[model samples]
Target: MKNSFIFLFLLYSTILFSQKTTDYLLDKKEISQRELNSLSNFPIYKAYEFSDKGGVYNLVLGENQQKITKKDTLNTKIKAICAMNDHGGFLEKWSINDLLEAYEPKETNIWFWTKYCTLKDLDGDGYIEPIIVYGSKTEYGEVRRVKIITVYKNKKYVIRAVECDLDYCRSFKKDAAWNTLPQKVKTYVDQLVIKLRKEQNLLLKDG
Candidate 1:
């Protein structure tokens, strides 16, 4: 029994360490640059058993040439895979552009922006930085660069930005955020009128 338990533990640990994260949008399955935006897009696998509530379904063929389908009607019964998951209703029809354009500060709060903006503590500064993902295109959807404004409470200096995609990720770079603009990212920020500055930056208060 002791030997059996040790073998099982080793097997489990090996399997867990062997697996790596993936992004369905990319064909290669592996990339050097790790982006926080990939968190929202998780992996989905198709296996046995039929679920009526699920959005994705297909005809299954087994031994003896049997045909199995979840629903009889395709149009009315079948739902988009995205519609059933992550997407809060009608998200199946919307695109990345729609999400960026729809990020209203008052209507959708910080919790809601995780679908587009990801919070990460890559700098080890204790404070999590908001990494905003702009679009959802295969070739060029993710924003390679962004801005880091120093925020203050009462004229006290805050921590500096240590991590960045390039010079843009550094602090006090002029037109840094605008340099690697996503399609609607400029308009989206402009619409909100966020006051980001070099010395002190203010958060966009919920309207």
Candidate 2:
């Protein structure tokens, strides 16, 4: 029994250590970057299912997807995945461009944007930096946004979201409780970098 238990533990550890976190987005299973870019310009792009309840339907800049709307028959049945799972899902059929514009109040009821990441050696290290965007909407209609960047010794994922209104919206940018942009973003980015480094460390140790 002791030998059997030891063998099983070793097997589990081996499998766990062997797992590598590859880029799921760029993996061989899905469409290529060039194809995705081209499809983003399509008038009505098919939504790709990332998880069971989430997928993304791409659309052209000036066009719209009639299938994506508040009154659509399939709205309740489909979960429109954000470009990245780290980002959040949508609530209403706001204008795509509006949400895609900027992180502001007036930009509500339109589109969503996630291109505000700033990459620099924030820690004064001699290495290129990486930061990414993440945003989401809960079932209760609260918005969660996070920006993350990271390096070796430190990591974090600043996260913030709350029920929004006219009063809250105006103060969203400056409010400490509701805004998680710089801090949470930094956290998540750091987490990813640490994870990548750990994976590399394991690979090198094995090699």
TM-score of each: 0.21, 0.26
TM-score of predicted structure 2: 0.26
* Per-residue lDDT of candidate 1, residues 114-142 (tens digit): 23332223233333222332111111222
Best prediction by TM-score: 2
| Candidate 2 segments whose C-alpha is farther than 4 A from its true place | 24-207
User: Which residue runs does candidate 1 get wrong by more than 4 Å?
Assistant: 26-207
Candidate 2 has its poorest 10 consecutive residues by lDDT at 73-82
Backbone clash tally (model 2): 21
How many angstroms is residue 189 displaced in model 1 relative to the true structure, after the best TM-score fit?
Answer: 21
Residue-level lDDT for 3 in candidate 2: 100
For candidate 2, lDDT tens digit of each residue in 89-178? 333222122122244432222222224333344433332233333333333333423222222222322322222344443211222332
Clashing pairs in 1: none
Instruction: State model 2's lDDT.
Output: 0.32
What local lDDT score does residue 126 receive in model 2, on the 0 to 100 scale? 30
